[model samples]
Target chain A: MALAEPPLGRTTAPTRPAPQKVWVERIPPIWWVLGLFLLTLPAYANDFILFQVFGWTFILGMIALSLMFLAGYGGMVSLIQMSVAAMAGYMVAIFGTSGIAAISMDLPWWLYIPIAILIAAIFGTIVGALAVRTEGIYTIMITLAIAAAFFYFTRQNYTIFNGYTGFNLVVPPQLFGIDWRQPVPFYYLTLGWAAISYGVVIYVSRAPFGLALQGIRDNPRRMAALGFNVTAHRVAAYTFASVIAALAGILLVWQNAQIAPGTAGIPAVIDILVIAVIGGIGRPIGPFVGALIYVLLRTFSPDVLLTFGLSGERFKLLIGLGFLALVFFSPDGVLGLWDRWRARQARRGDPLTGEKGE
Target chain B: MKAFVTRHPTWSLIIGFVVAVLLWLIFAPWTEGMEDVLGRKRVFLNAIFGGVTLGALYFLVASGFTLIFGLMRNVNLAHGSLYLLGGYIGFEVSERTGSWLLAFPVVFVVVALLGLVLQNQVFRRMEGEELRQTMVTIGLSVVLADIMLWIWGGQSYTIFAPDWLSGPMTLPIVSGYRSSGEAVMLKYPAVRMAILFAAIVVGVAMWLILNRSRLGMLIRAGVDDREMLAASGVRIQYVFLAVFGFGAGLAGMAGIVGGTFQSLSPGEDTRFLLASLVVVIVGGMGSIPGAAIGALVIGLAEQLGLVYAPTYSVVFTFLIMAAVLAFRPQGLLGRA
Candidate 1:
C-alpha cells in the first residue's frame, strides 16, 4: 500500500501471463448473486438513494466502462468518450422536445435514439482516424483537443447546441406504459444495459480482434508486419466504445432530465478518465467500482467537509489527492489492489498484475 | 532577393508571402471606422499589442514545454499548474514585499525546487513510460490545482502591475493623419510592453543556449537519440532534470507576466496547458524557433478571431492545429 516507497517504473511494463483457460471465465456464481443484490436495491432504498446515488454512479460508470474498454483492452485512450455520451444526450434533446425549443425539431423519440448512437460512433471513428496514427502522447493530445473542440462547439453554438444553458427537462419516454424515469424502472433500465455492455466488453477482450489489438498495443509495427491492420482495429475499437458511451449518454439525459455544455466540458471528460483509472484499467469491473467510489465522494463530500469547516470545493481537493494516491500505489487501479490482496491470500507469490514475470 | 526567393521559394518566400497576405486580409477591414481616424488607429494598435503580448506569454510557456518533452520524451501535463503556482506565489510575494519584481526570482526558485521533486519522484520513476507519465502528471496537476483553489479561493484574481508598469505609455509610432509636431503617439500598456520585452529576452537567451552552447548540443542530441546520447557517457538524467526545472521555471515566469495583465483564475492552468499544446503542435515540438512561430500565429489568430468572432476565438487555434496536423503531422519545424 505504501506505493510511495516503491520508486515506480522499477520495471518497464506491467506484465502478467494471459489467462489461458476458458472454462474458468464462465459467469461466476458471485456475479449472479451480486447482480441479484444490485437489482433488489431499488426495492429497499428510497428514490434519492436508488436514483441519484446508485443510478448516477451506474450511468457515469458506463461512460468510464467505455473508456476502460478502449484503454484496457484496445490500448487506446479516447477522451472523447464523454463527448460521445453528451452528443447522444444532445441529439436526444434536439430531436425530441425536452427544452430549448430554439433548437429542438421535436421529432419522435425513437427516431433520434439510433441517429444519436450512429453519429457518436461515426464521431468516435473520425476521432480515432485522427488519433490512431499518432502514438502515446500525441494520441492523448489529439483526442483531448477534439474533446475540447466539441465542448467549445456545444457551448458556443446557440442555434443547435443551445449555448451554455443547453437543453433541460429531458425525460425518458414512456414505453409499455411504464415511466422509465421512475426509480426502480430507471435503475433496472440502467442495470440491464450496464450488464449487457459489461458482457460485451469482457467478451470482446477475449475475442480474436481484442487479442489483435493488445498485440498492436505491445508493438504496432510487429502487428503490422504480421498482417494486422492497426489503424482499422484502433478505429473499430473507438466506434464500438462510442456506441456504449452513446447509450450511457441517453441514459444520462434521462437521469438528469438535462444536458448542458458542462456535460462535455474538459473537467467532466477528465473526471471520467479519473474514474476509469482509479477503478483499475486491467479488468471490466474496475470502472463501476471506481464510479461507485467517485459518486460517494461527490455526494457525501459536502457534509463530510462541512464537519471540518472546509468548503465543498475542497471535495475536489480530496478527489485529486485520492486519484494521485491511487495512480502511484495501484497504477492498475482498485481492482488491481483487489487482485494483489487476493494473490497475497492465495500465497502463490504470483505477480499481482497483467504481465507474468519472466 | 530574387536569388534567395528562387533558391528557397517553398520554404521561405511562399510561406512568408502567404502569412503577410493573410494578415493584411484579416486586419485591412478594421479600418472601416477610418472616419474616426484616432479610434481606428487605437483599435488596430491595441489588437497588435495584445496579440504580440499574448504570443510572448504563450512562447514562455511553450518553450519550456517543448524543451522537457523533446529532451526526455516526457509529457509533464502539470507544467500549467507550475505556471499557476508561480502566479499565485508571485501574487502573494508581490503583495507581501510591495515590489512586483521580487516575485520573479522567488517564483523561479520555488517552482524549480518543486520541479526537482516532481522529476525525481514522479517523472524519474516513469522514464520512457509516456502514458504513466501523463496520468501521474495529470493527477499531480489536479491535486495542485485543487490545493491552490483551497488556499486562494475559487474566484479569479488579477494581480496589479507595479506602478512603473501599471499605466499606459505613448509609443513613438502614430496612426491616421497625425500632425508632424503633435503628440499623436499610440498609447499602449507598459505591462504588456514589458512582457513582450521579457519574452524576447527569454527567446533570444534560449536560442543562444540551445544553438550556441555545448550543453545545447547535448540537449539537442538527447532529443534526437536519448540512448545514443547517454551511451556517449553524458548523464541524460541530469539533462532531463535540468530541462524539467528550466521548463517549470519558464512556466512560473509566464504566470507572473500573465497574472499581472490577464486575469488569473483556477481554470487558467488547463487553458494555458492547452494553449501550449497548440503552440507545440504548430511549432515543431523540441524546436525553439518552431514554438515561437507557433505561439505568434496562435496568439495573433486568437486576438483577430476574438475581434471577428468573439465566441470562437479559441477555436481558431485548434483549426490551425488541425490544418497543420492534416498536412504536416511532425509540425512546421519538427524533424520527420
Candidate 2:
C-alpha cells in the first residue's frame, strides 16, 4: 500500500504527472481522472453492468461509509444504521408511491426526500439515545436487538409495512425531463452522491465533533472528566452517521425501485459491517475500495465459478473466507495494506539513496 | 417508580405477575371460541409447559455461553456454529446408525475437539482482546455456516428422538387456581420432559463440578484472580482452553437436543446465538443459575407472547433483555 505513494525527490525516477506538493492538499487530478473514467463507463458497459454492479456498489459503499465513520472515529460499533436506513426507505414508500395496492400520498420528490431523511435522523437519535449508554459489545448487542425488533415489527405489521412483501415501485422522479432510473443517469447520480458522501466523511473526520468522538472512543471516562458530554457526543455521532446511511437507503430503494425485509435483514446488515471492515475502517476511501472489490466478487463470482465447474453458492463461502482473511491479516483493510506497502518502499528507497530517515 | 422497581425488582415482579394472573383469570370466562377453547387457564398452563421446555433448551445453550464468559471473558459468537455443526454431525451419525440416542456423546466429543482447535488458533491468540476475538468468531461463524450450507444443501433437517422418549406423556390435573376449578387432562411431549430433566441434571452436574471438583476449584480460582493462580504456578491457560472446549462440547450437545426439539436450518445458528445473548443479558453474563432463570423467563414470554400477541413473539426476547439491561445494567444476577 505504501509502495503506491509518490516518491517525489528520491533516487527512483518519478512520473511527471505527480501533482505539486502544496501547503493544502488540493483535490488531486487522479480523482478527476478516475471520476471521468467512471462517468464514461455507461458508453461501453451495458445497463445491467452499470446499474446493478457499479451503481449498486456505490450505494452499498455509501451505507458502509456511515458505519466506518462511527466505528473508525467514535469507536462505537452500532448495528442499527441499516434499520435507520430502512426507516427512510419505508418513509419514502409511505410518503410517495409504491407497489402496494393502497392509496399512496405520492408526495413530491423534493418534499419527501427531506422529510424521509429528517424522520430517519430522528429515529437514529432515538435509537442512539438507547445505545450510547452501554460500552463495547453491549452496545453492539443493543443495536442488533433494536434492528431485529424493527425488522420483526415491519414484517408482521401489515397495515403500515404491507407485511413481509415490503413496498415496491418506488421509482426515481423525472425532475428534469430525464428518467433518473435510466442506466447512465442512475450511474452518474450514484457516483455524484458517493463523491458527496465521501467528501462529507473526509471533512467530518477532521471536524471537532469527529475528533471528540475519537477521544471518547479511546477513553470515554477521561473525556467525560474533561467536561465533554460523552453520551450526547456519541448520540450526535449516531445521528450524523444515520443521516449518511439514510441517504444511502433512499438511493438503494431508488436503485432497486423497492424495499423489503431482506433489504434490512440481519445478513444484509452484517454485510454492511463486513464491507466497512473489509475496506479498512481507518479511512474515508476504504469503504468505496472495499465496495469495488465486493461488487466485483458479488456480481461475477457465480459466473466465474461456473466456468471453473463450481456451484454458485460457493460465492458466499468465498466472501466469508475473504472477510476472515482480511480481518485476520490486515485489520486496517486494503488501505492499511497500501499504506504499509508504501511505507516499505519508501524505507527501502531511503537506504538505497542514503537519505537520512526520520 | 423506576428507582423503587430497580431496587426491589424481584418482589415487584412477583407482585405484578400475581396481579396479572388474577386479572387474566377474572376476564378469561368472558372470551369464548378459539381464544378460550382450551380454557384460558389451560392455555396458560400449556404456555408455561412450552416455556419450561424451551427454557430448558435455552439453558443448555446459555450455560456454555456463560461458562466461556465466566472463564475466558471471550464471547464465542461461533458457539452457535458448534451447535448446528454438532446437530448436523449427530444427524449424519444417527441416520447411519438408525439410532438417535447414540449421537449425543459423539457430538459432544467432536464439538469439544473443534472448540479446542478454535481456541488455540483464534481465541488463544486474541486472549482478553474482546473486539478482535468477536471479529474472529464472527468470521469463523460465517465460514462455518457457509460450509454447513455447502454440505447440508441449505435444506432444513430435524433430529428424532429414540423410540423410548418419542411419544407424549399425558398428565391428568385437577386444578382450583381458576374461578371454576375443574379436572383437565393435558398431553405434554416426553422429549420436553427429557430436555427439562437433562437441563436439571446438567445444572446440578455443573454446580457440583464447579463446587466439589478440584477442576471446578481451579476454574473458580481462575475466574476470581487469574494473576494469583498464575503466580502460584498453575497453568491456568490450559484450564481456560479446556473450559472453552468443554463449553463448545455442550453447545454441540445442545444442538442435537435442540434439533429434536425443533428443526435445524442454516440461519438457526444466529437465532440460537441471539437467544444465548438474551439469556446472557438476563441471566447475568457468567452465572449458571442466572442463565436458568433467564431462559425460563424468555421461553415462557416467547411462548405466551406468541399465543397472546402473535406478531410480537420475536420482539419479546429483545424486549425482556432490554428491560433487564435498562433496569439493571449489571443484569439480574451479574455483579457490578
lDDT of 2 by residue, A77-166 (tens): 888888888889888898888877583588898999999999999999988887876778777767876787787778887778776989
Give TM-scores for every candidate, taking all chains together and pairing residue i with residue i: 0.90, 0.90
Candidate 2, after superposition: displacement of residue A302 in Å? 1.4
Candidate 1 lDDT by residue in tens digits, B1-336: 577578777877678888797566334443445536424655556676788889999999999999998888877789889999999999999888988888899999999989988998888887877888899988888889888987888788778887878788877665444446443667788888988999999999999999899989889899889999999999988888888889998899799888988878888898888888889988987889999999999998888777767788767877898888888888988888
Flag regions of model 1 displaced more than 4 Å.
Answer: A1-25, A306-312, A348-358, B1-8, B22-42, B172-174, B178-185
Alpha-carbon shift of residue A230 in model 1 (angstroms): 1.9
lDDT, each prediction: 0.86, 0.84
Q: Compared with the true structure, what per-residue lDDT tens digits does model 2 show for residues B1-336?
A: 588589989988997998697556534443446344555656666777888899999899989999998888787888888889998999999999988878988899999999998888877876777877777787788889989998897789998888899888876542224445543456678988989999999999999999999999999888888889989999987998789889999999999998998989988898888788888888888888889888988998899888878887877877787788778877788877
Clashing residue pairs for model 2: A1-A338, A1-A341, A1-A342, A2-A338, A2-A341, A2-A342, A2-A343, A3-A341, A3-A342, B283-B290
Off by over 4 Å in 2: A1-25, A350-358, B1-39, B175-182
User: What is the Cα root-mean-square deviation between model 1 and the actual structure?
Assistant: 7.0
Interface root-mean-square deviation (Å) of every model: 1.5, 1.6
Clashing pairs in 1: A15-A354, A15-A355, A15-A356, A16-A354, A16-A355, A16-A356, A17-A356
